[model samples]
Target: MTTAPLASNSSPASVAEMEQSLEQLKVANYYLRVALDQVTDGVVIVESEPSDPKCGPKVLFSNAAAAMLAGADPETGLRGLGLNDLVAGDKDATTLQASLQQAVQNGGCHECECALQSLRTQAPIPCKWRVRAVFNSLRKLLNFTILISPAQPNAPAKADPKPAVEDLDAQSVQLRKENLAALAQGIAHDVNNLLGPVTVRLSALIQQVQEHPALAHELQAVFAGLKRAKQFTSQVVTASKAVPRKHEPTDLSALMRDTVEFAGAGSNVHVCVRQDDNLRLALADPVKLSQVLQNLVMNGIQAMPRGGYMDVEAHNHMVGGTGDGRLKPGPHVLLVVRDRGCGIARENLGRLFRESFTTKADGNGIGLTTCKRFIDEMGGEIRVTSTPNVGTEFRVYLPAAEGSGSTKPLSPADAAPVPLKHGKGKVLIVDDEDDLRKVANMILTRCGYEVVQCDNGQDAVKIYQSLFRTGTPPDVVLMDLTLRGGMNGTETAAEILHLDPEARIVCTSGSVTQEVQMVFLERGFVGVLPKPYEAGELTQTVHRVATMMKRN
Candidate 1:
């Protein structure tokens, strides 16, 4: 009787404890639901039917975040929905389905891009979500869940307020371009000035080389080499450096053919150009056009690693005519480069022409931008169209010859052909830099001309006066504009002109701007040469100017 009473009394106490444990469990479930609804990240729960490996997938539940992602109400969401509604159908859906199935079979899943790739591709990819598997104690898959949080794209790329380094880099690039352009022009100008007197003396010396035939032949070869070097410099100035050149008549087909050839050098891919002979003609700086074509074709070839075809075509065009090309009424030449390779992405097309934007891993990002600058300078335009896995096409339009690019004279053809110091004439080189003046003196002496040097305008004037006192002024005077003592090239030229009205003065300076070059020309200087000149250029300009003086 005592043992039975003890058992009966223990039953009610144990039952009360069990009821309290159930209430605690109920309270925990309620809090979990509250946390789910308030969470920032989307929470998706997809369970496997019958906990079987081969069972079809089913949505067990979804949190507020998940419903928001699916374009459903956050508060009263997950009533009924299909995964297909969220994931783009076809390939994307298949990939998602397979991933869900795998996660359920494995009892748990880990974060993977394939988990959210469907949403990333379709939705603007505002956030990146990672999927994980929830499993029971028996190691059986219960549900596959994913957490979604705002991704990098949603962070606003331009919102980095403290991007001092990037801002500096961008500024540096812009400054570099401006500095390069200015420096290049300055160098060209200075080169011309240095060569002015040297070229004049060389021409006169070449006339005297009639004495030693063998020596003259050797000197002629030197002159030829000098000429070639000048051409090379011209190419460099036009290519890497920014300087304007007189445009000349150019055949579009010929330009395209040469560009294709240039890009093909040492490359495995064969470049084929199909340009219409009847295509629009234009007055273009052949050198600049050459640079543009080469850059584009090279880019096309680089896009294809396995070697694909690059079709370059040219045709006459005018605005208002449809792209299909039955030309209606505009004035342009159409050059098209069609490539079969990995095409540019839709998102990337706008950035293609932006300076410093590069798709290539190793690219410096100047090729396309340079092309754009060249085309814009030529009064033309460019357009691009690309399809992923299909191909890319770049179309360039240049104004017709009659409309914009008309051929100019070939005065620059005789750019650097004369030998300095060889011509039989009196030459004067005036500059502030003694080393440069001596260099000019040596070059002119070797060319067989008597060369005198002056460091300033006052000295230059005295020399001319003394020469005139002896009844024979120099055949040519290479004058530096800024003599560093308030006496500029302009004033010096004026003083020399007063001494010898027929003075052949080639004013020189690299620092002289375009306006100053014009000033010197207007001041009656026979030629305007710049400093930083090559030996051949010096000799050539000297000869050309002296010959003109003699003719006059």
Candidate 2:
């Protein structure tokens, strides 16, 4: 009866259905292989022999990632490889085997960090592994599914030589200084952006009121105050840098007289400058050196609130012969600021240049520190001598230029404004800042030029292409270096140049570093107009570029 029942169960339709089911399983397996290959981490499976579960474990399957990790052909997989082939040494293999056995006994999951040797490279690769064991209903060991990921290499142990407390303290202090300097730099960048419009508009106003004598005088005074404020912001920026800006030979005596007059303008302190006509020019950043002199003179003036005279003297010195160890062995220009006022105490003299350490009730203490930093950056030295109830003197020794003469310092006289050349073509302005664009539009439109504006580089490029195609290419394009949510100024400039080889593009940015400026120039920019540019600067830069384009 059992034989007859078995024979009746196999119809043609049922056999066809069984065949279809087997085909579906094969398709599923193919899809699974595709999915596993797409993963980035390695996946592998190993099967253990039923009779010798502890010793004979062989690779049954491996995905493409796993094969690549093992340095094998992905199509061939890592099948038929023993556990010993993957692990670095006999000890590692034994450890892996034990871990597998433990996982099988305790519900089939284990994780470990191990070194696996690459078959092709023959180098040990550190890896983290998570292994899961599959089991039958009878609790027999079957196979292991492993996920392998590259692990960070362990740092080597060092000999136990305890570091000194003083070394640790110094490290901490240095780190703190670095962090503070970084913060100060970020603040300075933002402040510069905010001050840009004010500085430019103030210059514009001052230029406009020149016909009104009284009004011009008042605006000039305000402009001077703003200039001083701008200097302070620049000082903040310099405090964050390890080195000063580029140095050129500058007349130390002329700079000293200007700083003394500026510092003692409203104070009762009568400042007098004394220097020889043959004083050699000092190699320094003119602006930074001026700021240092101003700081010293201001300190001197503040020390004498009861109206006293301060002397500023400049002279030549042979460094080693000046009786100052801080000055190197070379020719130097010595500038001294002497004030007859209550001098610094002996105990506080050593800490005078330390930031945030001051004796005055109203002092923030960064003045002397900043002066010291600036002097050091110029490859110079600053020293002080003080006697209680007598006077305090600050001396700065800067390296003297080798040559007898120097280039005249940049001044308004040197940068005499170029007359606006009225143009017949359209001007395009691309910037993300709305206020800045508006300011630019006002200036360009007032100068008898048609102005177009865009807030991003992509739109600017599109507009430029459209204009070029229509046979009305812009006479000049003012581009901002950075734009949010689109292509940057450099990319846009390149695109525009592709559209029109003779396009005149001037790059602008508030935070334009020297490197960025160089990149802009290399990318076919006609000129670079730094942000917060005055109306005259913008017009002058545009006019120059446009005139060049016309000539070309």
TM-score of 2: 0.63
Candidate 1 C-alpha lDDT tens digits along 339-457: 88789999999998898999789988998998888778776777899998777999987767774433233232233333333467889988886667877788768767788888877
Error of 2 at 37 (Å): 32
TM-score for each predicted model, relative to the true structure: 0.48, 0.63
Poorest 10 consecutive residues of model 2 by lDDT?
410-419
lDDT of 2 by residue, 1-552 (tens): 345443466989988888789667856765787788788788888885533444347887787677666655333457768766788887778777777877787799988877777664445666787888888898876789889876643443365324444444544454345446555655765676676667666666776766898886666556565555656666565545443467778787657755665678889989888886678889887778888888889888878889899899988877665456666677788899999998999999999999899898988999889889888988899999999888999999898998754435435332222234455558899988787788778767877789999998778988999988888889899998666543567768889998888999998865454534675677799888865566778787877777784723
Which candidate's TM-score is highest?
2
Q: Which stretches of candidate 1 lie over 4 Å from their true place?
A: 1-249, 253-274, 283-288, 304-313, 317-328, 338-342, 362-366, 373-379, 386-391, 403-423, 431-448, 454-459, 482-488, 511-518, 530-541, 547-552
